[model samples]
Target: MYHLSSLQTKAIAFLLTLFSAGHLSGQGLKNYGNNYRDFAGKAYYFGLSFGVNRSNYQIVHSRQFIGNESIKIAESNDGPGFTVGIITNMKIGDYFDLRMIPSFSFVERNISYTGYTNLEDNMTRIESTFFEVPFQVRYKSKPYKDVKLYVVSGLKYGFDISSKSRTKRLTDQIRLSPHDFSVEAGAGIQFFLPYVIFSPELKFTQGIGNVLIYRNDLQESTVLEKILSRAFTISFHFEG
Candidate 1:
């Protein structure tokens, strides 16, 4: 027999309570109206989203690091950012919807190096204003009164439109390519109100290709192999 920890037991109990209250049980007749019906006849909708994100890089070391004296180790540090976007959603079936969001993200990411002989520990910062577009497919659970749970998966393309990158004023330590491509996945709960649907979502994006632009003239660039971008975002969407 297996045993559940006290914390696990409490977590399960809490989830059970929410599930019953939100999906399984009903209230008095006075509270039993369905807000979901308001949009039953609509095939499409538009929305706006705003979110906060934490962005970082995934670094892979190169062969040069084995004997490099200037850089002992290379790592990425998290940076905070914000996003604003427009959403377009189209119903594909009773349980599925196709979505596209075009957004702008203002972010800053850091790369730090451990010092070695003839060098001191240093950190480099990369700030970007990115224009991003993502295409996603969402699957929604059956509505529970005015609420529904959904999951989404998608692909994204982003381009850094920051002035520094365009004008070549970036730090001499390292440079990143302006283009980024990623895969995304997320989940959220939707609440249907009298006039609109509001959803709060959490999403993760992972870059599929290296964003590092190798600099042959810099030692800081030689200690690393590749850099990939990653971000975790919390978004709020409002639609009618």
Candidate 2:
């Protein structure tokens, strides 16, 4: 068996206690507001999502260097790609819930090499696939028995699991260990069913930090290099 240190055990205990207290308090509040407890339940949802993404280099007001080369930054797209994820809902009240989603997505960018010596082409295409997790707080309008609208705000963390690239004259592939974090916001509608609930949601996500690790050199780069796209995702959820 794995043994936890005293401090670790205490931290775990504290978190569990906090979680239990919050759950119990929510239950008590629901009981007191019995008239509004119709939406209290646990649900799991899985769905397919389609979206567009763009990637770009982070531009700094100050000049930066890569292997003694000075480069000017610009943003570009590799192209549109697809996304899919599963979501779990923890109902807190008639108007509030917690949502956790895990997803796999593809991002791409066409990057142009500017102010670089011995580089042949002006641009190349880079594509990457990511595994992402998002934690969201959802607030719903009053449930009208069968239909409701909700807004979601959250943070997402993503890891770049793989990447590939191709150019007009050459194809180069590399494995990147890039990680990303973002804040997301969106709204959607839900239709309740006897055994399942269906929700279609739209979300927008923006990166919170520079996504690149190497300044301009692609050969020795391990970072994602650029953020190719801001995405608009239309996701369908089946919850039960």
Candidate 3:
């Protein structure tokens, strides 16, 4: 079994309690009147999710890093990452909801730079694990009672819990204590059931800041690459 940390467990329990209370209150309100004037129709939901995140590094310009033998330079490319998290949703209106997705993700990137030689052969690798929180505002359209379509736009903040960099001449690994932010958008469909609600959503995230911590010339290798990370996710919700 996967044991959750104390903080994670507490967060999950809190979300569960909120959902349970909201559900009971909504039901009670519905029984009292044909149409509840207040957001009493509002409810909360919680779920577990796992997905893949694609990550890349944004180089500011061409630069070099001091190595044991030779100077190293490089560009960046997309790398595959993984994510797992707890999701919470709060009903905002008849056709809208607010969602919070707290997740732990492993992100990595490969940087290839031009060496002192004319041929571009130098490269390095940087990997990091992050704790991310995404807050989203969703617009849902339900033509029928059993089905709903939704679109969400959100912002995410990520804290670097672990980081390392590797190269040929030097294993220059630095631990960075920093956080990153990004903007995300996505759309998906939901199937509503009497017992549970199943939602499969796909989202895209683009980092707004530079991911590199070093002030070296290597940062300039790929200045044109603006996006730092991207992810596609599918999540399911169990309603109580």
Candidate 4:
């Protein structure tokens, strides 16, 4: 069974309590009216985002990794990353908006491999500087006082501006493609303050294609078949 860490449990409990309080407050019937009436009246708005991400790869090893006598084990480890972005939101309906965020991410991932007869493990660390653009459709719930809940679903296109595939010496290195596409989904709660809207969001991203560039000369690339990217991001957005 997968267990939540103590910190994660506490965080979940806190959010549940907050959501419950907001829901109860909304049911009191007394009109607590909207805070920023003019904010939503605008056709479009811009914002800024700062966030942290936990990134890793979902590996689908080839038959060689399992059945071949020369190969022992192969796996990947998660790494920490950060992001910064500019947010552009276009109002489409009373409850809908089109959102575009162009961002840069600094991420790292590690993969380890072992041979059948050798007890030693070889680990390869990959660093990617990704330029990403996400096109998302956001659906918001009715405002309860000054707070509202929203869900977003989207597609993201990313290019690794610092991919190692083009490096002169690729012989012993694990290489990845410069381009990738992913599907993304997330939910957030918005707090409409006096001057700006503050939102904290949690999102997930999964790659749609293999990002690995395989080379036969490299043993690190030979034991693997497909590599897909996955990440969980937590962001804070501020909009005027």
How many pairs collide in each candidate, listed in order?
0, 8, 13, 0
Runs in model 4 deviating more than 4 A are: 1-34, 117-119, 164-166
Model 2 Cα lDDT, one tens digit per residue, 1-240 = 012123323443453454345444454232232222333444434444444433333323222234334343333433556677776778775668888888888866555545445453355566768898999998776554466667778999987776422222243432223667888777676777665567776666667766644434354232234432345455677766
Worst 10 residues of 4 by lDDT: 1-10
> TM-score of every model?
0.85, 0.62, 0.65, 0.85
Native-to-model Cα distance after best TM-score fit, residue 169 in candidate 3, in Å: 13
Q: Better model by TM-score, 2 or 3?
A: 3
What is candidate 4's lDDT per residue for 45-90, written digit by digit as tens? 7999999987878788876666667657787777889999999999
Model 3 lDDT at residue 47: 77
- Give me candidate 4's TM-score against the actual structure: 0.85
Best by lDDT: 1
Worst ten in a row by lDDT for model 3: 30-39
Model 2 spans with C-alpha error above 4 angstroms:
1-73, 113-121, 163-177, 216-229
Could you tell me the lDDT of residue 91 within candidate 1?
95
Instruction: Kindly indicate the candidate among 1 and 4 with the higher lDDT.
Output: 1
